[model samples]
Target chain A: MKKLINYTPSTATRLFLGLLPFALLLLVYMGASEARLAENPNDRLLPSLTQMGDAIERLAMEPSKRTGELTFWQDTQSSLIRLLSGVAIAALFGLVLGLLTGALPVLNAWLAPLLTVISLIPPLAVLPILFIAIGLGEASKITLITIGIAPFIARDIQRSTQQIPTEQLVKAQTLGASTLQILMRVLLPQIMPRLIDAVRLSLGAGWLFLIAAEAISSTDGLGYRIFLVRRYMSMDIILPYVMWITLLAFLFDYLLGLLNRRLHPWSEGTNA
Target chain B: MSEPLIQATNVGKTYGQDVILERVNVDVHEGEFITLVGASGCGKSTFLKMILGTEQSSTGSLLLNGKPMPNEPGPDRGIVFQQYSVFPHMTVLDNVVAARGFQKASLTGLLFGRQKRQARDDAAAILEQVGLGHALKRYPHELSGGMKQRLAIAQAVICKPKILLLDEPFGALDPGIRADMHALILDLWKTHKLTIFMVTHDLKEGFYLGTRLWVFDKLRHDPQAPNAYGASITYDLPVSQEGRDTLDEITRQLGASRPTIPYKETA
Candidate 1:
């Protein structure tokens, strides 16, 4: 046998190894669920796979008792609307602010300290203030998500903007570019791919803030559904909802990665 | 004599207490290739930056055609650094085309439709002349050091600046590639009648490429405060005809300094 360090896995073996842990987790959950149910048929801690499937069908296919709407799709839609709106606004404002502060020394000096202080403040602590100021409607939740991630994105963009080579800027100026031209032409395009990457990194935090706000106060959302069902210990519904959320987050991440690679081929290929 | 295109009087620069260059005065006429040589940290690059207008001389004045050099970098002055001077996001063709667009257009830094097609044709012709026609679609990262420098040269010259500044443009290339670059630069300089200022670590390169050569070194040295005195143009030799003795003197002086030796003494 080859030494472990020297041995490299083939493509097929690598795929199998990647899937092993996930399969093991599934088996463990199924076995524990069976044992619990065999001991007490009424145990709600671990729902059998079939029970979770049934809960998913009911939530996905049937109308809710009170609202007459499919709770599953409704919750997903509401949560997605909030998440997208907040992230979109953050991206727009972040790009503008980051571009200005990074390219202009005066703006950088004035705003860098302020941005640093704002990023340092825990966004969740400000959630209560946001609810009081903006109210506990869709606006408050969206603002929470926006406030939670915009600074991070802006700060990231500022750094990437600053990181653009001085040579490139000088070259542009020598070509007779105005200050605004250099910003839009030389600096802006270079940092754009980086901005997409920064947004990708901040998505996880965005999801967290979204769920926190929804769980605290919301009539409809993925987090609201999960928290509402928890009163009856319906692990069947909660587990499937959790699985759904994970799938959505995974899909989002995959799509963003694809967009980055597609739109910014140079950034992905090699260092400049 | 006709007026010199560029004139300097008592040019000096300092950052805080660190004096980098001082009391530098020279006159460069049109179409003269002036190469600068100095030890590392001797402010050769600093002097080039001053000429490029990215940096200003702190103490003295520099003139172009009997007027002050523009405070902001403009189309009259084009420059190429050793590396990282090309736009990686753009393909070779776009890099050259963008230079023109940046100078002409007010926003988006782009030309569209008929103007865009015209720009592309002009860029293509220049790239072809630089032997980069085949790689017009390639990004900067995809090209080798030599090719990137070619692209840089193409970009610098596309705007037809009155002066071209190269700061060790070929320093990172291998010898075989450097020779090709030297030929290309000379050809371009002759064809375009460009007034060029280049800084090189290699003394032989300065001698071979430039009509006139300059050496930057400090006359005084203080042990405790190394930067108390700034470097000045120690030797201004016309390398086209009488540089042998000046080369020997430079090599001997560089040998004695024991550090920052940019050239070797030849027996």
Candidate 2:
């Protein structure tokens, strides 16, 4: 095998690069806030480092008061459950629809217009109708995510399935492989790299939609906590929660990126 | 004598308004190495396709082992294409073992590990035969052009088909590698006694490896027309035994003052 040049950054290097900016910003903010607090201890806009540390301790100690504490953890858990289940359901639907549309031209033509129309309507626009039909509860949020994500996944899978070379299919047929056999042995293996890429894209989109969904209507969630803190102009509490959310998102994204790299080593050079 | 392994009677093919081949007749005997030499667009590949059952002959019949060919590809005939046709994602072993997926190898036999041992053994043996024993775990992208061609040949022959069809298998290789592959093919043929039908445009290759050479002369009739007929026959020269002697005599005559007769036809 030919030796490939190693120019791409390793995972540890990427993580360090991603976190450096936030660390620097936090240090500058800490120094500036300390000076402001020392000048005017009673200023509503400024909070001392000790006061911010006290707020963190208080939020951790009293889980009942300060809607931020209860709402953040509750929303985080609910959003995760809905995202997981919604992804499962959407993948099931996408796999079937993608397979059928890829195998039959007539079905693809018939479903093209309907899928386009459905995909065109923004999930936010359909939120009210979803709320009216299913009430303002977990169902609404889960359904919103499912509708938002299924089309993109289906489209990605269908295009990937279609892009497999005809020569490979012909070779499989010459080997006496049946339709199912060909799909399982030849088509699936060839399209797996593309499918994993699509799934990673969908995961990012799913998180974005979850935040938007939680921000719209919810008694609890990380988004709701951030919004509630903003109303009182409490940057101390809001900044920490924002830090937590950013850290979580980064963790998920980094983990998925690692999985993608591990599964497809050939894709590393193209992933910049 | 028994019947030829493959017989084509008035086999014809037409694509819409264009006639590719018409009334083509050929009989391939067992263990006979035949080379079909033709210029491009002479329908040599189409004829091979008809034999492989990948394309339908619009007019007549084709028989393999004195039996009618089905509408799809079968294991009775194995084909090696000119381009790299191995599966890119599969290892060399998987690519070779895939040909047996439809035969006695059952789904349960494959899943429960009954066929794995046999497949590995067979793949190793065939890879050794084709000088690719060390490349069993390598993918297609890791192989060179010559190695890829050798892998294709090994994959085709691993199925043990009755007739092996090669469509310009060596046209893409360099001259040195092509010569080496030709010698390897001849050695394998001597041991396996396979009925080989190859399509090549190289005249020297045809003279070296073909038991019977078919020359497709396009300039026979109308020189201006693109479509022309051709002829072929078994080379029945006594030079098969005394080819070196004949070359020496020709050199001696050329060196002499007297010009030798160049028009004498020998058989």
Candidate 3:
């Protein structure tokens, strides 16, 4: 073979390398399911892929006998709406609060300690409080996710804002920017990309809070469907649902990454 | 001679009880290139900050154009720091145009077509002058050290400030690049007729570029009473062709009399 300056795997090799572990996992799961079904054909603990596919088709394509709605789509729509609403609110609130706390010493003195305290309290522990105070409806669940994650997002943005070099702020002032101008033009644009990254980082916990809230009192969410089917040992639906949630989270993460790369090319190495 | 462009009278800075600089007095004339040379922690940077109006004098007043300078920074004074002088997120072209946009409009007005094209044209012309015309779209991090400093100067000078303050603008560059920067600064100074104040530890650089040099050092020292006093302008020289010899002689005499004590511990 001709000598190469650097060893880089081809695209096909890279694809195989990325998929190998997942393929192995599926193989092991199928093998176990096949052996278990052979011994006990009525086994529900580990459903075969065929069984899961049938369940997914029923939930997704067929209308529910009682409500005349595609149950899977309904659950997905409700769950996504709640999750996105909570995340959007948290991100907006975090940016404003973080900017205030980071830029102004007086505000930092007043709000930073309180925000620290809020961030420390276990979000799951406060689910009951939210349900009680806000009523056991969509409001409570969305509030739960917001409460669980907003403080963290806020804290991340505050620290990022604080870490902006003093020289940049002074330089902005020298360039004829007023305090408000500095905050809006100089600080806001810089903080936004980091804020998106912070949201990306906090998303896993956000999903946890969302699912927990949905499992407790939700009427028609993905988490509600999962918990509702658990009593009947419906592994076919549950397993696929779990995978679907993971796939959704992955998709959202990928989209956000693309958005960050597109909108804020300046943040590549520094943030990524 | 024209009236003094900047005048510092007994300016002093202190952080609570500890003094950083004291009894600093100077009269900077129009179109003069002045350089401040001192050891680290000798309050050279602090003195420059006072002139920039970012920091206030705890004791005396700093006057610019016969009026006491404001406590805050304004467009009348432009400064290029050693690092992070360019806004990292902005492109080179955007960075230069930002000064024009900000000076004329608020953030909302800037978003609309309220002179943006004019600003871009002006900025492009300035960038061409600074030799960064080809790199207008590049970010600050994409530029070499020399290019970044040149962009910083372009951004500062575009504002047409009466005074341009540089805090070790070439301190981070290699010798070859530093020489290029020195030439660029001198060229800009002559073209703009700007009053410039620069702080640097390189004695040769201070002696070379400046029309006048101010050397800050601790004149009074007692290890037991360290916080009792701090640095001051111990030697001031007017760097004329013949005055260069006098400056060298004074530097030799001062070095012989004053032993070097690390200012870090005292500071």
The candidate maximizing DockQ is: 1
Please write out the lDDT profile of model 1 over residues B1-267, one tens digit for every residue: 899999999999999999999999999999999999988888999988888887888998999999988776778888988988898899999999999898775876788899899999999999999999999998888899999999999999999998999999998888888889999999999999999999998888899999999988887888799999999999898899975787888878966765545653222
Q: Candidate 1 at B196: error in angstroms?
A: 0.4
Candidate 3 lDDT, tens digit per residue, A98-197? 9989998899999999999999999899988887798998999888888888999999999999988888888888888877778887888899998889
Candidate 1 Cα misplacement greater than 4 A, ranges: A1-8, A269-271, B243-245, B264-267
Local error of candidate 2 at B196, Å?
A: 3.3
Chain A TM-scores of each predicted structure, in the order given, are: 0.96, 0.78, 0.94
**Residue pairs clashing, model 2:** A75-A221
Ranking by lDDT: 1, 3, 2
Better of 1 and 3 by DockQ: 1
- Name the DockQ score for candidate 2: 0.21
Those runs of model 3 whose alpha carbons end farther than 4 Å from true positions after fitting are A1-17, A269-272, B108-114, B225-227, B242-267
TM-score of each: 0.96, 0.74, 0.92
lDDT of 1: 0.90
Assess each prediction's global lDDT (C-alpha) against the native. 0.90, 0.69, 0.86
